[model samples]
Target: MRKALTLLGTGLAAALALTACGGGNNASAPSAAATLDPANPTTVTVGATPTPQAKILEFVDQKLAKEAGIDLEIKEFDDYQTPNIALSDGSLDANYFQHLPFLEDQMKTKGYKFEHGAPIHIEPYAGFSAKHKKISEIPDGATIAITNDPGNQPRALKLLESAGLLKDIKDDSSALTLSDEQNPKKLKFEENQPEILLPLVKDPKIDMAIINGNYILDAGLNTDDALVVESVKDSPYGNFLVWRAGEETPAIAKLEELLHSPEVKAYIEKTWPNGDVTPAF
Candidate 1:
C-alpha cells in the first residue's frame, strides 16, 4: 500500500477574489516608499511552497527578521501556479518558490511584470524509483512520471537525457517536450503537477519519477535513495525571491539580503546536509 501524504491546497478562490477586485493585471500600484518608518518593523506577506521555501522563511522570521525591522508573513502554496497568480493579483508582497527559467516562462506567457532577487539556493532535480534500484535496471518501455508544467517539463526531460535515457533534446526551452524518437529506452511518461509526482512514484505502475528536490524532502524521501541526481555545478535552476517590478521596498530588500546572508546559507547547509538543497550564493 502507498503511504498517504499531506499536500497543501492553493488559495485559488482568494486569488480570484483579489483579481476580480482590479487586482489582476492592473492591481493597485505599490506604495511609492516604505509606508512605515525605518525604526518600525514592516510586515511583508510572501507566498511559497511548503517545504524548503517556507521552512527557510520561518527560520528567517524567527531568527533574523526582527533585528532587520521586518516581519515576515509566509503563505504556503502547494501548486506552482498559485504563488505567481497571488503575486500578480496583489494577494502577496512577494514569492520565493521558483527558478529563473520557470520565472521567465511565467512572465513571458502570463504577461506578469515581475522582478527577482539573486538566486538563493539550488534544489537539485533527482530521479527516484521503488521498482528499480539503478537506472540500468529500468527496462525499456517503462512508465516514468514527470511534471507537466512547461518550465519544469524540460528539466525532467533533461534529467532523463543526462541519464542516457533520451537524446537530442532541443536547445530551445519552448520547443522541448517528450518525444518517443528521442527516448532510446522507449520510456513512457506520465505527466502531472509538480506536487503530485512524489506520490505517483510510489504507484506500482510507475517505474521511476523525476521529482523536484523540495518535493523529495516533503515526502520524507532520502536524497541518497535517488537512482540519479542532477549535477549542481553551474546549474541554472536555482530558486530565488520574486516580487512585482518597480514595487520593491526597504522591507523586501531587507528580506532579500537576509535570504543570501551567511546565516541562511548555514541553516540550509545544516538542514539538508546531503546536498539535496545547496546554497547558490
Candidate 2:
C-alpha cells in the first residue's frame, strides 16, 4: 500500500475559497513601507505547505521569533497555486513553499509579481515507484505520473532524463509530450496536481512518479524509497520565502535570517539526515 499524506479538509477548503475568488478583487498593491515596528511587532500571516515549511516556521515562532520581536501566523496550504493567489490578493502577507523556477513560471504565466527572500532548504526531487523496485524493471508502454504545472512538468521530465528514462527535455517546455524516438519504452505520461500525486501514483495503472521533495517526508516516504533522487551538491531547487514584489518587511527579513541560523541548521540535520533535505544556506 502507498503511504499518502492526508491533507486537512478545512485548509483545502480555505485555499479553494481564496483561489476561487480569482483576480476579481481589485485591491491595490500594498504600500512598500515596512509592516513591522521593532517596538511593537505585528503578526504576519504567511501561507505554507504543512511539511517542512510550516514545521520550520513553527520552530522559528517558538524558539526565535519572540526574542526578535517577530510574530508569524502560518496558514497551511496544500495546493501550490492557492498560496500565490492569496499572496497576490493581499490575503496572505507572505508564503514559504516555492523555489525560484516555480515562482518565476507562476509570475510569467499568471502575471503575479512576487519577490523572494534567501533560500531555506532544498528538497531533492525524486522518482518513486509502486510497480517496480528499480528503474531497469520498468516495462515498455509503462505510464509515468508527474506534476502537471508549468513549473514542475519540465523539471520532472529532466529528472526522468537524468535517470535514463526519457530525452530531449528543454527547461521551459510547457507542453510535455513523448515521441517514439524520445521514448524508447513507449512510455506514456500523465500529469496531476502536486497535492494528490502520491495517492494517484499508487494506482496499478501508473508505473513511476516524480514527487517534489517537500511532499516526500509528509507522505511517510523518504530518500530510501525513491528509485532515483536529485543530487544536493549545488541543486537549484532550494525553496524560499516569497511575498508581493514590494511588500517585503523587516519581520520577513528577520524570518529569512533565522531560517539560515545555526539553530535551524542543526534542526534540519537532526530531522532529515542522509541527504533527504539539504539546508541551502
Prediction-by-prediction clash tally = 0, 0
lDDT of candidates 1 onward, in order: 0.79, 0.75
**What's the TM for model 1?**
0.86
Pick out the ten consecutive residues of candidate 2 with the lowest summed lDDT: 21-30
Q: Model 2 over residues 186-217: C-alpha lDDT tens digits? A: 77778877777888658899898888877887
Candidate 2 lDDT score at position 15:
53
User: Which candidate number maximizes lDDT?
Assistant: 1
Q: How many backbone clashes does candidate 2 have?
A: 0
Among these predictions, the greatest TM-score belongs to 1
Error of 1 at 81 (Å): 0.9
If scored against the real structure, what TM-score would every candidate get? 0.86, 0.85
Worst 10 residues of 1 by lDDT: 20-29
